[model samples]
Target: MTHPENPSTFDTVLVANRGEIAVRVIRSARAHGYRTVAVYSDADAGAPHVALADDAVRLGPAPAADSYLDVDAVIAAARTGGAQAIHPGYGFLAENARFARAVADAGLVFIGPTPDAIDLMGDKAAAKRRMADAGVPLLPGYQGTDQSDETLLAEADRIGLPLMVKAAAGGGGKGMRLVTDATDLRDALAAARREATSAFGDDTLILERALLHPRHVEIQVLADTHGNVVALGERDCSVQRRHQKVVEEAPSPAIDAVTRAAMQQAAVTAAADIGYVGAGTVEFLLDVERRDGDHQAFAFLEMNTRLQVEHPVTELVTGIDLVEWQLRVARGEALAFGQDDITLDGHAIEVRLYAEDPSNGYLPQTGTVEAWQPPTGAGIRVDAGIAAGQQVTAHYDPMLAKVIAHGRDRDEARRRLADALDRLVCLGVTTNRTFLARVLRHPVFAEGGATTSFLTDHDVTGVDLDPRDVAAVAGWRQLAATADAERRSPGLAGWTNATWLVDSRPLRVGADDRVVSLQATVDGIVVTVDDQRVLVTGTPDALRVEGRPVHLTVHRPGGDRLLVHLPHVDLDVSDPTGLPPGADDAAGAGVLVAPMHGAVTAVAATVGQQVEAGSQVVVMEAMKMEHVIRADVAGTLVEVVDVGDQVGVGAVVARIDPADTDG
Candidate 1:
């Protein structure tokens, strides 16, 4: 029997973040025969990470500034818990170079790249320069130190039209702008600089050439101190909204063998150049529909020094546990396998299920997970952390779970994912289930014609909100009304009272509005309107309409409204007379309201502050994304809210004084 190489292993490790990632880290560590410690804030005392760890320590209150991002608090937790290492799972302090240095100075392994490497790659401009120096292909744009509007315009003209303005120290799509014309260059530069300054504490701006309908592809690379590097194929993250990834899939449908090899080789080269000694990703923008459709070229788009949120897709295809490798590398082990030893099989796709309203422009939603039940079946994996009754608070990211499906190929994977989504049951809050299901079933997506602009080009506004469906709901309500009339007074059925029948009844079902006319019958009950008959069977509590079983629960009073549980949607049925007037509106004014329940991280707008439409007024930290509430109309701000205050849906954060209204 042969012993494993570099058998050294730490007995205890600390997870430096909260929610699903922390829980995920703890599980992986335990599987590797290591004790785990969890650190959380007051809002996360009942979080899954705290409950699952061998030891739990509370940092501070719910606000991130006071806990997760506090270096001293995390170090103190590590000391008290007697942990030997710390794993900063993706957000919070994952990319903070200073924190990494502090961990090393405290004689604790950081479980990531060296602090020098993090500092070098953490700066976007500096990393780009390093990549260029390493003989890697870079975007044909300016990486200069000048931020003047005149110099930026000249650089844009030189780089050609339709260029991108990006922050030198930004990730997750913050401080990014797309300018299509020369007229908007100066303002765009100023805005980008301001955003960059606010987000990364650095305001330097850079220019990049924008590709039209480009596919976003990235390569996963791993390295060790033994001078070995391996590329784990590619992932297509083209489907995005507001520049944040919504769906990710491995074995990208757009790249062929030749293009795949080129990208993978480039990723390996980038890692070796940086002396990267951990898991990192090399992002690229692939052109899909050129004269040479088979010909693919890529440019370096920065490297993430830690494990990515989409790492599961790579794991599903390559059969490699990246967390295990991070542990192995920390133990000073040499590369166990060379590049040739790594193999990629099957296809995998991951969908980020967030607590946000898709119909409401994908605005983040917050509340308790009233009823959270995940689907269980073959070839489906659910990486979830929150339980059924967990509170989806405003202090963290809005993602509820990550649903991934692996199959023999892309089509099978898509089919399995769609099936899993169909069986998913989530109550109380709105989700992106129906919208993502439509994406999976979309003809273009099935054909693999998706790009970064797929969500923008595809029209998902009218899906599941049709007026025809509303009329069908009206049919269900007519049955309920007839049953109620019969149950109220069985003797009055034959008399056919005139006063009992003429009232107009309105019902609000789903997102549509409709009116139903009901008539009573002698037998059970015959419901008819517009020459269509809806047969009602069983009692009102358990209704069978048109040979379909439905569990009906009345939500409010007036006895006219009921919830019909269906496979795809929850139908709200009510009499037309009971329906509220002036509902189902999709228009609004220029007031910037809170996207979800969150504290105002920064309130930049002041009364009488002149701003153009789309200028950021407030930054709200909700879910995982930093949502910047922007101005919808060009006007002077009339109302401003203080920072560090709580806000929620329709809660006005700022209001633009009307041009016509007097002060």
Candidate 2:
């Protein structure tokens, strides 16, 4: 192992990224005694990564195009900061060949693959063609340059039904659509094209025949500038929603020794063929239906020309710090060991924790993280960029953190991950923590049989909120808040006449508007919700509902807002008395509001136009993903917001006159 005291080629490195990846790279760079520099946008001036770095530079505003994605600005920052190299992390311009070339032209090393390799693998169509020429098996698809809608439609017909339309210039499930019917082809193409153009500046797409119940697996490949390439192992990323991976695990349960060896060899070959250097991932779609002994049919997907978000699982299993290896390779170092020296160990599983709601159709959420407490234990690891009081805006991806667990076997790993997820407490915004925990504990996932359609085929999103638990926590929070107020105001406490008076408060919990009534008594408090009552005893720190102790963490982020964090559930409690009449209720029946904070990219609805329920009225772009806001009730549009307008959650974008109304 190389020691930190040993001299390296680069003495200082600039991380041209933000969030957790920047923090990860800075940690690795500092561990090797290299000075680290961080770049931040206006929104991240006080972010953890900024404070962690030895030096920092301000880029621009919050939007990535003006900040992180601006190659000139990033290079200028690196030069001004006296950085010898730049690490692009996983997103932004990490896989951009032009950015890589710019860094090299600026006389600074880009801590990733060569510009040629990135360009070759960055284009899905070109990469697929190259892999096919190299004798790599590929799924039947179209990768031609004729991108006209007419040509694409014809090719879709020729390729047959159930095809996947994917963006040729990007991944991360953006600009990808799965079309199973001919009627949906045109709409899918338009949506895919719009998203691709917005995300990657390219509307070009490729079509491939959709595999039946396939396992989405990718092999982690590492190579240096020298002639050495090795595949660490494979990761199963089949548990997905909207083609975006949710859960991933190293040493895929579906893969046997024979299949593993074949996939590894193919991945290494693909890397060498592209002259790949540094860390890259070769993704493949493994057909679960085609199984013969240890051999399974698989086809090339596309190569992620940089370190993957799920790289931690592979690192745990192989005992390798991929970022360190990337830095080493960027310094013109050769691979210290060959494939023969690489080995895999215990099982590891990772789940992405996002600030989105599964029940609300997985809409992205934005707000301040009033309270954040990730789990901590021997086998639990959390790579998160968020902290208490940090704002989660619509400027970036909704993924807040990643929680991983490693154990001796799959079951142990699964159990540990589930427990860790249950222990996590994130408040002041909606999240997918409960949904992820449910999936991890589901029978199909536990048995290692989850496919790409796991989310589609299962009811993992529905979390039955127990009114008892909600009321108990709400009552506890109310009493705690009263006690706090009394401590601050002795006059108010004296006016309350605590010995003779019982104060009653009404609070609303969750988006469903479930109301809980609490009454403070001399002996603890009484909680009532929907005709059910329970006696809560003990203090705020150790509360008992009906003689049963419950563990809870409470945070008050302003007037009437209480965040109660319980096991496997976090409830946002608000005082209904503090809200204007009907403010806590759902939006008016004929109004179409923004489901989340985003820019209105398209408005299909016009005033005086009649539309049916479920018709898409507005399309919003946020967190690099597009969401179509549909009409909740059939009506004639009376008012409509225009495109290019930035809207907040619950802001009315359109107003419609109900079809049954005479107005």
Pick the lDDT winner: 2
Runs with alpha carbons beyond 4 Å of true place in candidate 1: 1-9, 290-295, 466-545, 548-567, 570-595, 598-638, 642-646, 654-663
Tally clashing residue pairs in candidate 1: 13
lDDT of 1 by residue, 488-511 (tens): 978553365353453245555555
Model 2: C-alpha RMSD to truth?
3.2
lDDT of 2 by residue, 1-663 (tens): 111223255799999988888988899889988899999999988888899999999999999999999999999999889998898999899989999988877778888888899988889999999999988789989999999999999999999989999999978999999999999999999999999999999999999999858999999999986789999999999998888999999999998889989999999999999888889999999998886456898999999999899999998989999998988887778999899988889999999999998987899999988888989997888888878888899999899999999999999999999999888989898899988999999999999999998888898787787877876777677667667888899558525534644445566677556556666666667777776887888878878888988888888788877788777788887867688786755576778888899999888878988888889999999899999988888889998888889999989999878876344
Instruction: Compute each candidate's TM-score over C-alphas.
Output: 0.85, 0.94
Q: In model 1, what lDDT does residue 69 have?
A: 89
Off by over 4 Å in 2: 1-8, 292-294, 478-504, 514-524, 581-588, 659-663
lDDT, candidates in the order shown = 0.77, 0.87
TM-score, cand. 2 vs. native: 0.94
Backbone clash count, each prediction separately: 13, 0
Q: What is the lDDT of residue 500 in candidate 1?
A: 43
